[model samples]
Target: FNKYQVTAKPFFATDSCISCGLCEKACPVHNIRVVDKPVWGEFCTSCLACYHVCPQQAVQYGKATRNKHQYFNPHQ
Candidate 1:
């Protein structure tokens, strides 16, 4: 079930991304690196922390999430 519930799919950042380190910092496993953009490592637990923590909402995981709603809960 980990494959469905969690994935290591590479995240794509749009032009709106500010290259901030929030996504990197948000990753509990340290699976993200921000060079000019975010680079995901295989250690991703698919927590989606990088996606929700983004202030620009610029993080996307393939076409499946293109139109999907992004939910961010600080309490998580």
Candidate 2:
């Protein structure tokens, strides 16, 4: 029997987002989108530049992360 695994978690933009579009611009995969609200595309590699570059500290990943400081890093 084979077990299926899901490794990637979708990036969520928090209400603290200032909509500055820095995340979108910094995304190497171009998966981050900024409209009136920020959206994560399927191409997201979980690079975490959005979370790091966000001036408002509004981006996070995973349900386990319920704090303002927890962030996701693809390289790590």
Candidate 3:
């Protein structure tokens, strides 16, 4: 977790989101809805399952994903 996390919310690049529904499926807390726009529910625990599973790399967690090494753990 971030001690100084800037806004705990999933930043979906809607244009990049291919509407694959992986984000919704990967949501551990069932807090995401991929409609015209991704509707993030209040139950989000920030588990980041969807962020990693996203093949399109559309789901981002703040600015941390920018040029950072992605720890791809599909077995998780």
Best by TM-score: 1
TM-score-superior candidate, 2 or 3: 3
* Top candidate when judged by lDDT against the true structure: 1
Better of 1 and 3 by lDDT: 1
Tens-digit per-residue lDDT, 13-52, candidate 1? 9899999989999899998999999999877887788887
Global lDDT of model 3:
0.70
Model 1 pairs whose backbones collide: none
Q: TM-score, each model?
A: 0.78, 0.68, 0.72
Better of 2 and 3 by lDDT: 3
Off by over 4 Å in 2: 1-9, 64-76
User: Clash number for every model?
Assistant: 0, 0, 0
| lDDT (tens digit, per residue) of candidate 3 on 11-64 | 655477888898788777787888865667666666777777787777787676
Model 2 alpha-carbon miss at residue 54, Å: 0.4
Model 2 misses residue 42 by how many Å? 0.7
